[model samples]
Target: MTAIELRNVSRWYGNVVAVNDVTMTIGPGVTGLLGPNGAGKSTILHMIAGFLQPSRGELVVGSRPSWQNPAIYRRLGLVPERDSVYAFLTGEQFVLATAKLHELADPGAAALRAIAMTDMADAAGRRVATYSKGMRQRIKVAAALVHDPEIILLDEPFNGMDPRQRIHMMELLGKLGAEGRVILFSSHVLEEVERLSGTIQVMVAGRLAASGDFRAIRRLMTSRPHVFLIRSSDDRRLAAALIGRPEVAAVELGPAGLQVRTSDFGAFCAQIAVLARDSGIRLRELLPTDESLESVFGYLIAN
Candidate 1:
């Protein structure tokens, strides 16, 4: 089932457009929403979580309109980007309160379950204000999961988590996803998204850049112009010979080495290896250019 849908959604703040004609669907399983900082990713998440109304398009959760629909809250739980929560209340109290507000039959049992799921049972009696950042994040996720919401929206969920904490959270999310729930989380970290999400929605400059399996997106992103930092015995002769080859598209001499942009990344790499072996050029270093998410977003914006 389609968990969320934005139909040409546009959100504006005075004159600035935060989300521009964005339309996409988030379905079951773990879906990664990706974009650079201030790329309308947060805005999109806010709209889906019913925190912000779309200026011009419809935001729907399942078959019902989500804006101003408190009924959806029963089935949708949101873990916001902001850390602000009921800090004065203990973790157990906070989660119990959410359950009570949801009118769950047994709030105490619900809270206990949530605390255990988050591994915060040991700290359940402590006030949220006393918890560490990672602890607080765990509580927030636990609260979101307390009611067993069908659709869970998380924004930068792994932002401040250590490697171990991140792994823990990822495992929890994986468990929730395996139970056939819809988990949509947003992040800018390339590897993080690639690791957790089976499908990803790429956003760039308030626009939907791409959406598909990670391997397909990787193929698309990795297929284009690639700059290889090649080090050889005779840099000058290697540069001349490389640029002369039909596989290479462009060349630039740099302080570290020559930067060659090759259209055929696979063929260019193979040719370079063979050329180095045959010509007796002592190859020293070779590394693909760093393809950060920022650079990927730049490509989307460029087009």
Candidate 2:
């Protein structure tokens, strides 16, 4: 079943169109929103979360209109990009208060379960002002889960988390998805989203750029030249050896190192390791300088 649906939704700000004729459905699974800064992702999230009303068309949650409906919140949970929660309240107090606001029968038990779910029980009594950014995020997550909503929307949720916290959050979200919850998260980082989300929606410059399963979208993305910067002990020799290969289109020795442009990503990478072995040259560093989500968004928008 579709937990959320947007039909021909359009929103504008003083003649600047933020979302243009966008339509989508969020089902019971984890979906990643991929876009650069100012891609209208936040606007879309706000509209779906019932915070912002669409100027045209309909936004629905389970076949019911989501706009200005407090009742829909009973099944919806949102974690905004902004970290402006009740900073003065301790973790436990904040979560308990949120649960109480939902009129939960046992707010204390609900809050305790939320805290435990987020693994913040140890720091539940500590004031949020004294907590780290990662801890604060966990507290916010706990607050969102306090009501046990069926749908969750998170915007840049990996913001302040370290690698460990990021992985932990991913695991938690995966578990949520496995339990058939609607989990939608927004992120500007491609690699993280690629690993975490089953589907991806790409937005570019206030427009929906692309939408599909990540594997299909990744194929679309990798169709372009996989640009690489290679630093090797024998730059001249390696460049000469790789220049005539079918996968290698262009190679140049620049200020940093050797810049390689290849249409075949797998072949290029495999060939690099083989070249190093046969030529007895050690490759110092290999970097994909154009593999960022921002670059991908720019490429898609331009295309």
Leading candidate by TM-score: 1
Error of 1 at 246 (Å): 9.6
State TM-scores per candidate.
0.78, 0.77
For model 1 the local lDDT of residue 273 reads: 77
The 10-residue segment of model 2 with minimum total lDDT is 214-223
RMSD of each: 4.2, 4.4
Model 1 earns a TM-score of 0.78
Native-to-model Cα distance after best TM-score fit, residue 222 in candidate 2, in Å: 9.3
True-vs-predicted CA distance for residue 140, candidate 1, Å: 0.9
State the lDDT at 71 in candidate 2: 97
Over 4 Å off in model 2, which ranges?
220-298
